[model samples]
Target chain A: MASDDSVSLRVTPLFSLCQELGARFTPFAGYRMALSFPAGTLREHQHTREAASLFDVSHMGQIVVSGPDRVALLESLTPASIRALPPGRLRYSMFTTPTGGVLDDLMIACRGDDLMVVVNAARREADLAHLREAARGHAADVALLEDQALLALQGPAAAAVLSALAAGVGDLPFLGMGPFALDGVLCWVSRSGYTGEDGFEISVKATHVEPLARRLLADPRVAPAGLAARDTLRLEAGLCLNGADLTPSITPVEAGLGWVVGRERRLDGQFPGSDVLFQQLAEGPAWCRVGLRLAGRAVARPGAPVLDPQGAEVGVVTSGGFSPTLNQPIAMARVPAALASPGQPLAVRVRDHQLDALVTALPFVPARTVGRACSGPSEPRNKP
Target chain B: MSKVYYTEDHEWIRVEDGKEGTVGITDFAQAQMGDVVFVELPPVGTVLTQGEQAAVVESVKAASELYAPVSGTVVAVNPDLPDAPGTVNEDPQGEGWFFRLALTQPNELADLMDQDAYEVFVAEAGESAG
Candidate 1:
């Protein structure tokens, strides 16, 4: 569907099915998307953690870059090593400005001939424009695949549910992508998702999305999840939302995304903002992104000012919310590097009074992504 | 039965006696807020003015302010909220009472809508928000 704000909202192919299942619709990124089903956000959040949930993420922008110099062109826009990425694998990268600030975080999949990029819906227009400029500069071809509908089936039971519907899906490794057929309809399946749970993101033709979703939902283990649960899931997983966590002034090093930048690229210093990024790497950023475990139940949402023990403003919370899995309030903030250590006491000015908070490690809940060991440094469980 | 009155902000006040009343959000408010995870109540003996921010209700996705329905002094608050805030979502009108306010101007109750009028107001709000 076409994207426009003044005109009617763009509808996903599964819109009617979601309506039939009693979904509450909300306008998101110029599309009418399901906020939650009749079971509500809480039930949907818990269900996905306990079992499995299907999410309609068709509003995101999916693009394909091809040509003889495709990898070279893609590498110019992002800091990640696009030329080194192996086929059938996905890498999480960001389009950075010359000043090292993030334009958008995206998942790039190398498919031998062309590279597929999945970008955030809110930044779709800007990302496309950026891609066009890069293509013009490098003489490459970029096409937005508007005819595809992307769906994510996530949770512990996600693999089983997907394997039952499509063969060869269960064997895919984490961050793996390949062509597959669901009920004889050609689709591309990736063994990755934003929930930090073992799951798959399936891209199918718009016309085939409804039947595929309905067939997958027929299993007792799968339930329809919406944007509300998705946001909480990602927050609990310590994943960054594009606009909130990664902003125009926040660099990858400052956002704890140094792992995404390849070492070879770091040594050669060829990408955008490479000089500044190298300097930041040598001397840590002024502010480092850290996770905060709030003392009380009062949620510290985004824009809340983070303060030190002496009532000095140290940082600002980028993403904060109530964690359904942890059963407490958790937040991510960008604070001075000196006070970023775990167990450091901090205060958050939520509304009127300052609430006590502790600087803790990220991923409020431990991630259970399949075939991947927990990446970050191991920390004690349940400190707060 | 105590007479229930509603504010334009969707807060409900049930007058228990001539001088004291209880305040809480209506079922419509809680439903719209999704899951209630935390509730911040005004301390006892705090003086409140009509249409002023009195308490805070935090859900999974958002935090909403609960306004004072009538001018009063908070005499009591629900003690079960800190440990279990879902009580507001389970039974918002009953055990979910936010606080007991001793009315300073009982005549201010006339400014609120009755149950019937509140239902009509809620319908209009739903239409506008939708």
Candidate 2:
């Protein structure tokens, strides 16, 4: 099943840094990303849990939309309420197809006059096209800033480690964005990350990426994390990966992202697939994504068949793995709406093995951020 | 001396004590897989059919299926190897042995390639990669 083609993609500026750390590099999203360091994936995963880990996510797209009509122009393309977002706040939004299917999920942060967007590295081209097409009739402008490198310094001690590199970072609340100086380099910093931990996503110029990464890694708490831990971490956090858990055919509503579509946007009914999403919201989706904890040690991997009490095929596992955090097998499945309820028992057949499983609330790990409580924007939360 | 045999799938088996056999992935196979992280061992006493996947080995690169070289009942599995998956890289033949099987038919070893032929196969694979 392996390909014979020898096609090496462009390496990031931190390629040598990863190698110096003895990172096991693997091809991902057209970039050679570290799968784990010399400590191995298990330790790398554990290290991130205990302290901090530096991730080179520079391959992710970082774009800026400026001009007077930036907020309005951006709101037309995404389902989130960008116009309502106060300056220095970030919102999770997804680009949708004409029919309202999600093209990609991204983070949009408002930086005063300009809007900073971070997108999945794999969907850079399609997301850019969607932005360009939406910008055609708008009053604002779009600029894809290829020069910015995205770096995620994540874990419990992440704030303490990053505070040393960048000043005034300690004051920034979760999901809040502001400009900061790292090594005298002015970069857009957002208090957000993929790992279900409190962290920061710093957008710096590509040239300054390596130096900042090194400075951050110099702290004893931070180890170089690769895609393997990243995947496991995100999965434990109950986050859905783009190609695996979502695609253009899956709408945001069906993907459990109805909250992103602001109340105003939902009422306006101008966004793509608004009618279908609204209807689905009124009457639950035919199939909803649910989390499953395998009854036994058997893993229910993606494409594995799900059976009912009578052994009839009911659904398929969209994403499944051994959750290092939970110390057991877990999975996400697109099952019939009736079985989507939490605490329901189900069976997953893997190679003639019918393993018992139970539906549970997503985010095997509860979000540790200061979010979920504050209905309002991230700002105005003063630190003690 | 215990005789060693190899399968085309890059697995090596060493028959010992007449009917008992120790199975492991070859060194060449481990090198091709890069860094080994997790080794899924078969349950002790589970009967495995020849050429069927009896266990799994997951490296940092990808997860691979380890085929049973000879049909037999699993007798013992190396429990230490899971916590120290790097044993597969450190000693692919000794401590990294996946499991021991009580062979149902010792004659199946005749179907596998001998050490010399296995070396030739590994050499050819290296040449193909080059």
Query: How well is each residue in A1-384 modelled by candidate 2, as lDDT tens digits?
Result: 232222566677788888888775667888877767767665677788789888889888888888887877777777778878889998888887666678888888888879988889899887888888878888777788867788988888988888887768977878888889988899888888887788888888889999899888888888888888888787777787887777777776676766767777877867777777778777767777778898655556788888777788898888887777786778888788788878888899876678888888887876666554242222221110
Every candidate's chain B TM-score: 0.96, 0.97
Clashes of each: 0, 1
lDDT of 1 at A276: 77
Candidate 2, residue A95: how far the Cα is off, in Å: 1.1
Q: Per-residue lDDT of B1-130 in model 2, one digit per residue for the tens?
A: 7889999998999997769899999998886665576777889989998999998876644568899999999999999987888899889988899999999988888999999999998888765542
True contacts kept of 1: 0.62
**Ten residues in a row with the worst lDDT in model 1 chain B?**
B121-130
True lDDT of residue B67, candidate 1: 96
- What TM-score, over all chains together, does every model reach? 0.95, 0.87
Best-fitting candidate, measured by lDDT? 1
Q: Each candidate's lDDT (Cα)?
A: 0.87, 0.79
Provide fnat values for all models in the order shown: 0.62, 0.06
